[model samples]
Target: MPRTPQPRTAVLASADLSFRTRVREALTGLRWEVQEAQGGAEALAYLEARPCEAMIVDTWLPDLEIQEFLAECEKRHPQTDLIAVDDPGPERGPERTQARSPRRNEVLLALRRGQDADHEPQGDGASWNGMPEMTPVHDRTVVREEIFVRGTAVVEATRPGAEPGPGTVRLPELIGEAPAMLEVSRRIRLVAPRAATVLVQGPTGSGKELVARAIHRLSPRANRRLVALNCAAIPDTLLEAELFGHTRGAFTGAVQGRIGRIEAADGGTLFLDEIGEMPLALQAKLLRFLETGEVQRIGDNDPIRVDVRIVAATHRSLAEMVKAGSFRADLYYRLAVFLIRTPGLGERPEDLPLLVERLLARMAEQAPVRRLSAEAMERLRQHAWPGNVRELQHVLERAAILAAESPEIGAAEIEFGETF
Candidate 1:
């Protein structure tokens, strides 16, 4: 049998005439349905009333701080994929700085792979495909010696449908040499640059948000904001207004006009966490947004424009939900452009020591460094982490606080949970 055609995607962006025109043209070429939002309050209302596979947001809105908007989104609808954008200039401030250069060698390594020489440096002022030349590096010795640093390259230049490298995020302190984690890092590297919708499926506390953040940090849109929303935390009735903004007097509590999450995150990423819990009625609306990048606010006639990318996560089996008719199949197809499954802690037992050590180091920044005993390490490996990394962090934090008097934490200090 022939394969079915894919559903269209929604592109939410700002009302700036030129910007909106450019976005519509770009997405139209990709066969995506485009939606428009004027600002944060307007975008949120539209998203709540209509659903989209993914979204694009701008960081610097006329109203509302982009980070604060993402926080609200995390609290309201967690399953939507959010991409944030910002002015490409240097005025983005501290948050932009932290996210921009997540890993120093990522770009350099990507360029190096295209070179012909094993250790030979590309000539100074070397340019690629008409793009500006990369920063000139003079140290040949360092380049030769550091070429094969511990891990394999997480990304590759193979065409689509090729075997993907490990698709996971790699944090500086996240230990473990497990193949699963390596694969996750590879996926992050591959998808970060492209504007595809990403579906991150994993159990709660499994670092789904962390993976999402890693993608944004490494992506072309890193300088922009990364907005996150949680689907389960917010009530159904209020969810629409929260996602797509409302005009003044649209509803009972309409003291003033409001901008939604979708509009607020234009020009960046919008992360929707815990998407499986989204209500059925909202699913259809979301499907509409994904199909057409236009959003009609509650009691409003005009549709605003916005630009964003979507990265969604969930622990539940959406397939089951689709069968039960709780989730929309069309929406599922749009969001699953690239799916990444995060391995549970139990699946990567070898990483326990590394995880513990890193957590301890982070804690030490606030207090003193503490060590974990062999017995404790063994127990951690043996036990099942149902809550995954989030659970592990909590346990370590508690243990650290309790072991403040001692330099080391033993198995006795560890609180064990039930097996999965």
Candidate 2:
């Protein structure tokens, strides 16, 4: 009898068991022995102990950064082909997928199968027994594919040095290409045309005010004034008057009758920042105004009618506050007619490169533009980013200053602030 060939061994490394199972099933019919590892450290250890023909790594790992792990794999086990899968979530597209294996079709098919399993609809007769058709091989160059979902509008990903499709909504103010940021832009477009109340919820420094400005700019009242009031900045004693205006001699320091923020924003929009910090008593007044579109000034008998769309933003959870009796339920419902949540920097780490580029370009307006070294970018990727995008801006500013005469910022110049 002739000698039999040994089965090629493959490793599936991920923190998600379902992802591993799906990929394993997809590769079942092939002549391969599949091994599972929970994280990068475990996978690395396995590769050292036993030789594998190929290894599939997840973009996120519990024990190591994806970039670091990939670099190590290249340096140590250069013979083993590597393929990394991004979070198979609906929000993220398969843009960063890279494969050097001759069995690239099998790898891509396995990836597609995993993604399909993730988005499998309930109670539908679907079969995964058939092999997926691979894209025709026209050239060695791989073109990027990006899907930006906006209200049933699918804009294909643009190639490098190519213009974006006309259907794409270009938001110059928002400097991120992450799925979370794309969703924010979609919501803005959907709600901007209407006069609905918008509640922007996010952690501090997550660009809530920027969302408000974008809404105002896109609204039908764009030609009119956009009046903003910081509910947390003004004292409770003066907030009511500042919001509803006050007649002369209404109270101490009431120099003259002035139009309040609401009145000033008539036919436009009124942005109330830190609305969660508003006093319960003032909440009642604000709710009444929202319900009737009327504002009653201090020492005034008549209630003035005002037509202003309300755009409120808060870092705190109004629902939790309502449960705690700090925020009124009725007012919360009124303000939260339409809600938009801004994701934290930690939630969308993939956008860091684009954000860094845009922020550095903006900083160039005041100073010479400085490029970030690969090591510096890797350092940024490892941070927790508890302060979100605002903190990123501050860090970059400090790094630029620290770089001094140098045109490029290095890892030594990148400093992170203490997280409370």
Candidate 3:
């Protein structure tokens, strides 16, 4: 008997009902198990709960901005394939008619033709002196399809080893071979075995969370859960309940008993990202937990003891925040038992080529990978990655998409702009 084919998993994010229907139909034909989301935030939430093999995101969404959504996707699911789609406007003029042609078809044609130019009109048109004319157009359907296929293949090829079993959660493996990365790895190994609470400081997008995960994976609590909570992301009102569990009748809409993150990571590591944003009152509670290894669930009189280790990270300078009185000095002292400062992408320019190579290799699974021009690499190295490694990944991902329809990524394709 023949074995059944594994279902291709995908998350489709778009608010347009008709467009979503069409996309779903196309993916269904390709034997994909399609999950739908109305916007970027919803898409991200879906991905966080159950990561898919590939994500098809519309450039425009109501809830979250496009670039931000893509960045989050890259950070959370680096191995998953990403395909961005843009709408083709009315089919009126010569350009409009060409734009209306399926973008997936266009991308596929470009890849097949080994073309390095953007989509351009071909053949004769109504013109003075009856001359043939060609013009560039923007619909990239063929390219999108090619990208999807290539990305899916890469995800399969580089799927991380099976999910770490209970008491053995796997963390994000840092991706660089540069001297900076070597030092970071050495630091992680040195601090992993000890029960010290670690503080990871870096600029936003510098992969602070990734560094935290590596520490957890290498630490004595490697066999436990590595629960991560973004302090800045959680609202101040509910931050307390999120970090510490609340009883069924604790507060408004508290319908059921819930286990907070600290307790959930009982025998593992609790990674508090953007720890500087944690509220002043909550800081005291956290400090107490660290000192006594006990957490008191909200609305409960008793404190529950847990054996979890804490790994906190932040992009802000806590020392400055402490001076400003926005953050607690005592809490910082408790969390910073060990400190590992992560270097930004610009700080380690030597790793650009290796990082670019790995990104292209992953991108190749979605389309024919293209080689970066020397000028392109030089230009990339020159830019100050304020968003750090995350920004670099986005730039490369976008370049890959642009180059997937061409044979090479040129200086123009390496365009860098302001990213928040």
User: How do the predictions measure up, each by TM-score?
Assistant: 0.62, 0.61, 0.58
- State the lDDT at 22 in candidate 2: 85
Supply the TM-score for candidate 3: 0.58
Candidate 1 per-residue lDDT over residues 193-269, each given as its tens digit = 56788999987877788788767754546556777889888998888877777899999989888877777777888
RMSD of each: 17.1, 20.6, 19.0
Against the unseen true structure, what C-alpha lDDT does each candidate score?
Answer: 0.63, 0.75, 0.67
CA displacement after TM-score superposition, residue 213 of candidate 3 (Å): 1.4
- Please report the TM-score between candidate 1 and the true structure: 0.62
State which candidate, 2 or 3, has the greater lDDT: 2
Ordered by TM-score, highest first, the candidates read 1, 2, 3
Instruction: Give candidate 3 misplaced runs (Cα > 4 Å).
Output: 1-172
- Candidate scoring better on TM-score of 2 and 3: 2
Q: Return the top candidate by lDDT.
A: 2
